[model samples]
Target: MNHPSGLSAAAVQVYRLRVTHPTDSVTELGCRAGLPPEVVVAAESELTRLGLLRTSPAGGWVAVGPETATEELVAATEHEILQLQVALGATRAKMQALSAHYMEARSLRSARGDIETVRGLDNIRAVIDDLARTATTTVDTLAPGGGQGEQALSAALPNDLRVLSRGCQLRILFQDSARRHKPTGQYVTRITAAGAQARCLSHLPTRMILYGDDCAVLPIDHERTGLGVIVVRDASVLGFLRWLYDHHWSQATDFFVDEHESPLGLSSVEAEILSQLASGRTNPTISAELGMSERTVARIVAGLMERLGAGSRFEAGVRAVQLGWVS
Candidate 1:
């Protein structure tokens, strides 16, 4: 017995008899189709399932046209296919997540030592890029100096946004002088608007970056960052670095605050300059230590002198102390 359109042979025969009769009881249909009553009943159920058989307005049963049944069967199959496609998409996502976990685990296993040295600026940047791409929890950065150039900031923006897009934390700390640099300010604004945290301190010890609790990157020499970097994976060292970061973070000011809004009416850089002058530090010394050009330092000093109504640097320092601007 052959079947057609997914219908059993008995079901097809029963359907044909019902179609010809147009009105028939299960026993009569079975007698005509040469099938038993039970077989006819089962076939009727199959036709009903496929929409080939339905109750008539004034009779026991009727057979629908093959076109309507074919349409109904095709629609149900298409719906099942759509459901399967959705299931496949979800499975693919899970597989990708598992692969990432496996790769990270394998890399960890291959990294035998707690300390790895990455020499040259390009190599260091590459490692940092990889870390940003793989960061799961947090990416912390301490950038010391006046500010970063627009090119460098632009280059980092994509990865910074990517980290935040994945629900990872991205926090950056820049020197107070960076607030006056337009490009740095714009970069900070963009990132902070994208869920990244940013702060500024008057001075910072060095450049360091942390990728979650797993690893930390530090310049080989704070004064010579272009030389290379050292990646520290020692848990104890990472713990200490995190502690230091937290401490500095507590003392830092939010980057969004305006310089004019300071309680003392002095920007952080100006206040730091005043403090160094009070200690009898020369302009060049302050300039070099603060990573500012001598001309910029001189300009800031002139502004401070006028604000304090002092004509000489010595008088400016004394007046700053008297005004409680410095100790």
Candidate 2:
């Protein structure tokens, strides 16, 4: 039962049976080892294929001649071990390279003299221009409200387009409101067609732009006036922006607008029903207010509930709020 080379106890038992009872068939070997006959047969076949055992018509199954079986088993095991070792070495090398890159980026950012707070539009624009000029690898951005105008867009768009044309990766996140704007949606579509990745979220946090690891462009005005804020050679600030983007990205829904269907543009009766539901009116009250029969109102409510995937009137109202139908 002791396997020095880490083979399973079952494998060791099967090997021992083959060596001890050279004339035994697979069924007899299985019985001796208290294993199922099928398991013993499979093991025997594998061993024979690996040159660890020999089979003969007259002798049934037997260990390979002399030390050949032992040598073959040892060689196979060593080959497997060497493969694992090589894989481990490659994995370690990759980890080390990534660690070195991260450390070097941190060092470069730390060495940049005096961290400056962007207080106005000019300061923000200066930083953005510098970051855009310096970006070599990729850039990720989330701009809400179609705020990237013709000039800014004209400048950044070309660089982004160039990057896409050359096969560098760029991902942009936008707010749902921005998609309703024709120009913004057209820009997104154009860049997307050119191979830049873009998605729309139900909501986006404050406007921000990241250029590789070295710089970030944020809004100076909380209301996103033409003002911009820039952080140059600041790794910590860039890291914070990256984390915020990831958090929003995970929660944002895919940006597929179904033009043929409208969930919130309900009919007159449906609109009345939803209004009553949002106002916490019971079905009977809703029926009286709309001058509809109780049975009819109940059916309409049921239909709306099913469409919205809600379990109750309260839940339906909550979903309406989420979908921007109510409040």
Candidate 3:
């Protein structure tokens, strides 16, 4: 039978035998319980661990009352739960104070028309649509993560086309990892076919959407994009952002099938993976960062090792560096 207190049947049997004969020896307990001496000893040890048994003054085993043990266990569990609730309450209080400060700062910025915060997915999309509609010269974006979700791609298509139709140049930059994502590749190809400029780099510093020269939208939280966004209209900030964009664009490679291979004949994904490996990142970490499966990462590593004529990952990394495949 299953035990709510997590006692094994042997332990329960041994415990019952001990309770009935409070001064019984291990051998006697074993005989009465129909178990070997070793099993009885094991069950006794388990019972002792759970506070169901104790050593008497005469060195014989003693049985602890189940009600007493149960009361102690419940007290300990309640104490732990109360401590956790206290910690949670403290954290909530601090968070509320910080949130209030942030709201005040945001209101001040909004009053000056320098920054506007848009919360939630729906509101952010509305702001993006409005900005895209007003864009006159350029709509440049940097997508930092590997792949855009299907829903995001679908939602952006209409806004992208609207900008392009109004004679606004649409340029997008993505991380090298996105090149291996089939949906992202197809989306880029489709947009490029419709007069959009697309490029990719080994890494992107942030996610941003710049509409014209003065207006830009950026995520409020870098690691959690769905939380909200902040639109910046300050010329000084926009200038720096534009400069950052141009810097990455100058170093970025064109988004095309033919451009997938580098001068060393390594695919962008392979090169990025090799670089990460050489920097002492494990396959799992590389897979997570690149948004690829661990199995896919292993396969790619195996292929790279064979191509580089290396026997192990360390040797592959060394050879790749020597051959300038990674720095």
**Top candidate (TM-score):** 1
Model 2's alpha-carbon lDDT is 0.69
lDDT of every model, 2 decimals:
0.86, 0.69, 0.84
Which prediction has more favorable TM-score, 1 or 2? 1
Question: Which stretches in model 2 have alpha-carbon errors above 4 Å?
Answer: 1-114, 118-123, 146-152, 165-167, 256-327
Cα-based TM-score, every candidate: 0.62, 0.43, 0.59
Encode model 1's per-residue lDDT on 1-327: one tens digit a residue.
Answer: 658477889988888888788677777877888889999989889989878999888987888998988898899999999999999999999999899788888488536346888997688778888889989999999988778878889989999999999999999998877878888989988999999999988878788999999889998888888889989888888899999999999998898776543588887789999998888889998876676889999999999999999989999999999989987
Model 1 lDDT vs. the true structure?
A: 0.86
Ranking by TM-score: 1, 3, 2
Model 3 stretches astray by more than 4 angstroms: 1-113, 260-263, 307-315, 322-324
Model 2, range 178-204, lDDT digits (tens) per residue?
545666666777788887777665445
Superposed Cα deviation of residue 173, candidate 3 (Å): 1.5
lDDT of 3 by residue, 1-327 (tens): 636778888999988888878788778888898899999999999999878998889867788899997888799999999999999999999999897787587457644248878898888887788678767899999997777888889888888888888888999998777777788888888888889998888777779999777588999987688889999988888899999999999988887744457788888788888898788789987876766779988999899899999988899889989988877
Q: How many clashes in candidate 3?
A: 0
